[model samples]
Structure formats: C-alpha cells, structure tokens
Target: MSESFTINRKEQLLEVAARLFKQRGYAATSMRDLAAELGIEAASLYHHIKSKEEILETICFELASKFSNAIAEVNDIYFNAEEKLRMAIKSHVQIITENTNQSAVFLQEWRNLSEPKLNAFMKLRDAYENGIRVILKDGMNEDVFADVDEKFASLTILSTVNWINEWYNPNGKMNAEEIAQKLCDFILGGLRKKLVTDINYKP
Candidate 1:
C-alpha cells in the first residue's frame, strides 16, 4: 500500500499560506514570503508540500467544495422559489462570514490555477450559478418576483451577494443572521414593482 502522512508541518503551511494568499493574492505571494510568515526557511516547507500551487489548490478546492455542498443542501429543502433564494443568500453569507480567510482565498485566488484545474473549478462554479438561476426562474414563474429580465436579474442578485465578502465583518456590529435578513429584504424589494393601479387609487 502507499504511504500516508499524518498531520504535521504541511497542515501548518496550508493554514499560514491561506492568510498570505488572501492578503497578497496568488500572483504576488511568494514561497519565501509564506515561509517567513510561518517562521521557517523556504526550503523546509518542501518536506511537506511539493510547491505553492498545491497550497492554492488546497484552499480553492476546500472552499469550492464547502460552497457546493451548501448549495446542494439548500436545494434539498422543499421551500418555495422565493424562500429558496433567501436560504441561498443566507447560506452563502454565513459560510463566508464564518471562514473569512478561506473564503477570501477561494474568491480571489482562483485565477492562479492551471488550465486543467481551472476548467474543473469553472464547472463547479457554473453549477452554483445555474442553481441560483433556476431559483430566479421559479420565482418569476410564481409571480412573486416582478416581471424582469431573468438573466440580468440573476446576475445582479449574485453580484450583490458576492460583494459581501469585501466588507462583511463577523466581529462587526451586525451578526450574520441580521445581515442576511436585511439583504434578503433589500433584494426582494428591488425585484418587486408596485401595483400601478394602486398608485392613484386610495381606499
């Protein structure tokens, strides 16, 4: 049988590398920089990991899998389309909020992957977009969402959710639940239009 390694320096390297990657990004971060952060020589890291690309792969794959699993779990729920959309927002926000470093590495460092690996990641990424798009289509069908361009509306909604990573702070005044609720309400409000007939009619 092949040999398997136990938890050791490599795990530590992965952890520290994630932070550096988030701060400096994949293109700018160097192996020497990662080694210095971990208080070890650059060559020592090689004993555990083959190269820096492995670190990027580990972070990206882990985050992608977490996000993929969360989306799948939400799909299993029997809620209506609008409710599903809310749950998707809450799930995405909560995951990123809780694991800020990993989430950051996953979001910004994806471009560092090799072509084959990037293709694989894109497939998973598209799965998420497709899942959200289906929910948007369902909401449109249910008449809960106003008559809007499904594709454009879906893109806008996804962009809004993705931007939260830039400013959302778990240690800040607002908790994840509160932020999710506020965002859900805000997006839903925009997606809906006032009944024109009621504009001029007063009870």
Candidate 2:
C-alpha cells in the first residue's frame, strides 16, 4: 500500500476506536469489535493498531497534549486574570466541541490507562487544573474576585466546563463560541466580588 493509504487507514482506525470507546466504554470495547466496525478482520486491525490499550492511550494523550498546549498559549498572553480565565474557558470549550467523541473518551477512559502512563496523564491533568488555579489566585490577590478558595473555585469551574462534552450537541442551538461566552459569563459572575451599593434594598 502507498504511504498515504497507510496513514489514512491508521487514522480511520483511531476514529472508529474513539467512537466505540465513547459509546461502549473503554473496558468493554474489543479489538474484534473495532475490526467488525471497519469491515476488516481482527488481524487486519492489528496492522494499524497494536492493541486496544494503544488506541485508548493515543486518544487520551493526544487530548492531554491539546489541553496542555492551549493552557500554555493562554499563559503567554499579556492579559488580566479574568481575561485569561475567559480565554481558557473558550479554548477548552473549543477543543471539546471540535473533538467531542475523542474528548468524551479522554474524560471517561483516562483512568483505564496503565501505571506509568496513568501517572503521566495525571501530571498533565494536574498541570491543567493548576493553570486555572493560578488564574483564580491572581484574581483574588488583585481583588478582582471574591475571597474564595482557589482550589474549590478551580474545581468548580473545571467541573462545570469539562462536562460540556457529555451534553453538548454540535447540531444544537448554540455554537462553541456562544456556549463559551455564556459559560465565561456564568463562571466569572460568581467569582467577581459584588459591591454593597449594587445590592437591592428589599426592605
């Protein structure tokens, strides 16, 4: 086979594997199932992929790298904490929406990764969360945000945004930009310190 054909076949295998892993769960998806989906024998599937773990590893690490790179770019920009946080939210939502299937597999199946690989993945994950935590800390230190626990705030922000892959629909009413803006607004609204003058006198 030509080089182009070989590369295309490998990508197709990964795509199918991602879909199956998302729908069926990584532990439940079999190499034979992937082969059957591709209309090829199990042995043929081996030509492109060595094992199911390899496919899961590829999917998880590729997404980890994408997120790591995005956070790095956001960190380089000369912006305030709020702006950086918004950019991070937009970047993360864009990545998830653009690669919904792979994102789902990445979110759900990462725990299935083996020892050293699991440790490596966790480090990347921690770095990503820490990037957000740093932004929150900056905002609080500058008094741009309320006096909230950075760790809990970061966890809240990430938990709210990361689950977008589970329910976001590409064909839905909102695109990624709209969704990101709304999420940014929602999350930032909570973080920003409210002024006493802004409170309504209900008495």
Candidate 3:
C-alpha cells in the first residue's frame, strides 16, 4: 500500500478500536471483535495496529495530550483566574464533545493499561489536574474566589466535566458551548465569594 493509504488504515483502526472500546469496554473487546468491525481478518488488523493494547494507549495518550495542550494555552493567556478557568472548562468540554468516543474510552479504559503505561498515564492525568488546581489556588489567593481546598475543587470541576461523554448528546438541546457555559457558571458560582451586601442583608 502507499504511504498515505498506510496512514489512513492506521487511523481507521484506531477509530474503530475507540468505538469498540467505548461500547464494549476495554476488558471485553477482543482483537477479533475490532477486526470484525473493520471487515478484515484479525491477522490483518495486526498489520495496522500492533495489538489491542496499543490502540488503547493511543486513544488515552492522545486525549491526555489534548488536555495538556489546552491548559498550556490557557496558561499563556493573560486572563484573570476566573476567565482562565472558564476557558479551560470550554476547552475541556469541546474536546470531549468533539471526540466523544475516544474521550469515553480514555476515561473508562485507562485502567486496563499495563505497568509502565499505566504509570505514565497517571502522571499526565495528575499534571492536567494540577493545572486546574493551580488556577483554583491562584483565584483564592487573588480573593476572586472563596478559600476552598484546591485539590477538592479541582476534582469537583474535573469530575463534572469529564463525565460529559456519558450523557452528552450532540443532537440534544444543548451544544458543547452551552454546556460549557452552564458548567462554568455553576462551578464559578460556588467558588466566587459573595459580598455582604450581595447576600440580601437587611439592616
């Protein structure tokens, strides 16, 4: 096959693998199953991808890298903590919605990875979480946000957004931007400190 054809076949393999992994769960999806979806022999599937595990690794790491790059871009901008966080939320939701299948697999199937790859995936995952934690910490320090446990806050924000792949419908009422905005509002509402007069105080 030509070089372009080779690359296209590899991408097709990864796409099918991601969909299978999302639908069947990584532990249940066999190489034969993936090959069947592609209408090819299991042995021929190996020509495009080394193993099922390799496909899992690709999906997980590709999503991780996207998250890492997003936060890096958010960090580069000269925005207030709240604005930065809003951008991060939007970026995250967009990523999930754009690649819902791969995102689902990335979230649910990562644990199936073996020793070194699991460790590496954890590192990238932690770094991404820490990026948001830093924003929360900075917001608190700036007095723009209430003093909250950065770690817990980070987890809350991440857990809420990461599950978008579970129920987000592209053809549903809300688009990704709408969901991102609502999430940003909801999360920031909890974090934003209210002034005494703003609390509906009556003297």
On residues 112-181, what C-alpha lDDT tens digit does candidate 2 reach at each position? 9998999999999999999999999998887778889989999999998998888999999999999999
Candidate 3's TM-score reads 0.90
lDDT by residue for model 3 (1-203), tens = 54453558788889988988899999999888988998988899878777778889999999999999999999998468888999999999999999999999889899999989999999999999999999998888788888888899899999999978889988999999999999987886656677756432345
Residue 86 accuracy (lDDT) in model 3: 93
Candidate 3: what lDDT? 0.89
Q: Clash totals for all models, in order?
A: 0, 0, 0
Q: Which ranges in model 2 have alpha carbons more than 4 Å from their true place?
A: 1-7, 191-203
Candidate 1 matches the true fold with a TM-score of 0.86
Candidate numbers, best lDDT first, in rank order: 3, 2, 1
Model 1, 1-203: lDDT tens digits are 25657546677788788888878888898889998998888898888888778889888898888888888888898468878999999998888888787888887888889979889988988888888888888887887777788778888887887788889877799888888898887888655667756422345
Candidate 1 vs 3: which has more TM-score:
3
Task: Give the range where candidate 2 is weakest over 10 consecutive residues by summed lDDT.
Answer: 194-203
Provide C-alpha RMSD values for all models, in order. Answer: 4.7, 4.1, 3.9
Per-residue lDDT of 24 in model 2: 94
